[model samples]
Target chain A: MMILGPAHASPENIATMRELMGLDHSIPVQFIHYMGQLLKGDLGYSYHAGSPVSQELLRRFPATFELTTFAFVLMVLCSLPLGVVSGYYRNKTPDNVISVFTVMGLSMPTFWFGLLLIYIFFYKLGLAPPPMGRLSPDVAFPPRVTGLLLVDTLLNGDLKAFLSAFHQLILPGVTLAFFNLAIIVRTLKADLIETLEEDYIRTARAMGIGVKKVLLRHAFRNALLPTVTMIGAIYGSLLGGAVLTEVVFSWPGVGMYAVQSIRYLDYAGLQGFIIFYVIIFALITLLVDISYRWIDPRVQLD
Target chain B: MKEVLLEIRNLQTHFKTDEGEARAVNGVDLKVPKGETLGLVGESGCGKSVTALSIMRLVPEPPGRIIGGEIIFDGQDILKLREAEMRRMRGNTLSMIFQEPMTAMNPVYRIGSQMAEVIQLHQKVSKKEAMDRALDMLHKVGIPDPKQRLREYPHQISGGMRQRVLIAMALSSHPKMVIADEPTTALDVTIQAQILDLMNQLKEEMGTSNLLITHDLGVIFEMAQWVAVMYAGKIVEYAAVSDLFSQPLHPYTTGLMNSIPQIDQPVPKDKMLRSIPGMVPSLFDLLEGCTFQDRCNHVFDRCRREEPGLADLGSGHMVRCWLHG
Candidate 1:
């Protein structure tokens, strides 16, 4: 029904368009027909973009990858020390202060936080470039090397373009990282507190290991086991384009492509997006499973 | 008199629970002699473990703390040492073996790295040297194929093997004192004896003073040269092991000894197996006099009015009861 727009075209016109697109067949026939097309690596046609869905996905993949990678790196760098310190000195000053920010990070929606950053850094202070996409329209595109603008510009020895691209990434990257950081730290801190209570930790301390070794080597590694599962799940979503953060920053990533596909009733495009998400999610689950073996030997025993 | 190794004078450790401050170790005093095993026997929650932990200075703070008194170990006041000094002394001068061997080791680490880490911490040894020392310790503990055992995770080994690994870790530094808190409690009965035997053999070989805390009278009788019976966070009786058993004084001590199920001495058909009546008193609302007054069959007016101090009964036998005094 939504396939036809508000102009309310005649039934005859709808039938002709349907036949032209081969949608006139029964459901099973259409599925089998679509599978045959899929065998050739075709992800169907996107009426919304007027291009093949796979081509659109490939083009947007680099933008999403760069954004998620930056955000993930930021999350890891900030959360590990923050979580360990918060837990080691648990219920004390540093923990209390860190907890307050983490709670706020968890509470605020990604879209709202992204907008807030934009309001402060972009509108009020004029510190951020406009949230209008990857780069300013006036800047010439650097020669494609890695497909990530940050790397491609640096590869071309274009510092000016590198700075501009990095500026565009900052708000969204932070916005994406904040929520992920909140999850990881909360997980790590809680688990660390519990792990510290384990008999092994007390034994470790009694055996005269230094403060740093006891905390980091014994307690931290045990604590990180539970948090690894949380990180894997967060990673899969972040890799799938962090939908709300992408839309808020107007980063022309796969998430925007997905949103447009839905609004325009582009079923083929949506199907392709779902397929990509599942494949990435499966790979991430495998990585998490492998990590369990490395970090926790009892994984098999339990 | 053997030279004193570890002496505790009026050690008071308290825990802040929601109910109130739990006076876990209340005015406890005891001494361990060089190259001798002092068995600490008590009912569960009688501060035997707390006493052991206090000596290690590993009591969890905020909730648990050594609020008063001094612990002098090897001529140094343990409580007076700086944090760094205490750390150096740990696993070097003072080491501990915990109750639950199953959970006492880091499950994620190889037995080798975990043992090597403790050895390396107190000594300025390279990693390979530390590991060699670890391998030697494992061999000393009589673990079969010590080299291969070191590479295995804690769970891959049996509960008995884990306990042996713990013993190896505890003694790797040749500390001045080793506190074994029910080290074999979690293992099978057969394994328990083996572990205890291993500990005794090692203690004899190393001449490391041992503070063995256990609820089992038999274990105390077998392993300890001297025994201290604890009741409600204080030593109710202290004596040479043979003297304590032959003439068990403290009503609490007699009660514990009687409570042990006997195989050779059968109960009369009409008689029930003896057990101490009443529960250990709540540390939260401790009575004014003796903490055990409510549970003591020999309770009297003085016992209700004021607690008795441990009075020496000659030749190192002491009993904290009015009858003995």
Candidate 2:
């Protein structure tokens, strides 16, 4: 508010700001005004967006949500099985091969990888249509149901739009997933290997529990506790990584909206996105905590 | 006549380390009758625990090879059995209570869940039925409020409680034999006595045979019917506990008795405690003569030149020393 206000230092503007903040009155008065405004659903207008704060947020939120979810699904599909196999085979060829790929994914920057992917798939192979808006202009977009393009397309029973949307999503989502896949795989592998070496795992073996059961039941759940924290951290981390992905793919999502807000100095849009993500990251962290307790009975917070 | 549940004949478990083969359990021969308690007494690294692992087939393969000998357990040569068949026999026919109860049980799981899993693996029972059996075993092991206690995790309970829980789980399947590897060593004196008393009472009530492995002579004297004194991975003396203690034929066995603090004999405070000098020989070094020869005070030319086979003079007394002839 201070940065964008042209007459922020002017005596009149300063007085007006102070009155709006209720600073001219008592401290309790200002707190009440803040609470009242928050409760009513008035987020205040955007000098940059030029639309109601909520409407602009509502408009940009779907795009970001759609992109992140796609990337998350991609991460899970690749990392989980790879991690299991790597830990199971451990020092063998399978582990070696997976380790190589994981190292490659981890070492390469996500933005660099995104650009590389765009160059290969879009520019060279010409497999995907040149990365641009959510849907190509020639294809008529379906009626918005949930505001999520994929869901909206599916809801309208427009398979063509859904297929097209998915194809466009693949490169960006896979690129975003690369680094995350490396992280989850590394976490799962390290934890699983460590858990396997534990005396309980030896006890499990002594009790004649099968290797599969020992790995899946005895080791896997315990292994996932650390991975849950990793996932929660990634939930926030993905926001940053997604910016590069969104820019490269041109898929309209939170990251893309955020960059556009910063460039245009859309304070209301940027604030809305930031606040929305704080809530998101908090909720993800909460979910991780709950799941950790669910997975292992021994972890109890005093 | 009691039925012999296990007759381990000349069992030798060797680990092939980078240096050489380390025989953890070398040519150990013993027998335990059903419902009887046979105490295996040894110093650390003397193969008492290794023998227990061999009985359950829990020894790590590759580096650890049984080498030669037959672990005839429950009328089957466990060494000859396939991995799957051996696994089937482990919890149902033969179960083990490890020394460190804390590490023995999975900390992440509640005691009940782990116990129920062992029960369900062996029996085709419902989860509810398995849980009931777990609670029943917990009750038998003298745990208060078996149902509520079953829900408590290992860490939530004390070390003593964890041992009781492990004992309860081991006894749940009505295993023909239980191998306890220094089960009370980790507990304090009070808890140790409690666990020992509980084990004896439970064993008598269930009529389950036990292989009690420990270095504590006091515990061996208290609970063991037959005693086997192991030295350097070999049983130096094997006889009824009364006979073995009365006439300890092996020098190592006699030395061990002298080392244990006795209430009857009062020694001067400043006087050093009796100890058998010299460290246990490394497993990588093959014993050309007797493994205990270097440490034995009665070491003679024969003791240095040749190893002694377990020789029986009369009755059931057996000793592996040249002087025993």
DockQ of each: 0.87, 0.46
Q: TM-score of chain B, candidate 2?
A: 0.96
In order, the Cα lDDT scores of the candidates are 0.90, 0.82
Per-residue CA lDDT of model 1 for B1-325, tens digit only, reads: 5999999999999999988899999999999999999999998998999999899888888789999999999998989999999988888878899999999999889999998888878888999999999999999998999999989999999989889999999999898789999988889999999998998988899899999999999999889999999988999999999999999998999999888878898785866678889999987778988778888999999998887899998999989998777
Docking quality tier of candidate 1? high
Residue-level lDDT tens digits of model 2 in B1-325: 2688899999999988888888888899998988999999999999998899888887777668788899888788889999889888777878888888877778778888998998899999999999999988898888888889888888888889988988887777888898998999999999999999998998898888999999988899899888999988899899988998888989899989888887777885875468888888877776688888878888889887888999987777889999886
Q: Against the true structure, candidate 2 has what lDDT?
A: 0.82
Tell me the TM-score of chain B in each candidate: 0.98, 0.96
DockQ of 2: 0.46
**Residue B206, candidate 2: C-alpha displacement in angstroms:** 2.6
Instruction: Pick the lDDT winner.
Output: 1
Collision count for each candidate, in order: 0, 3
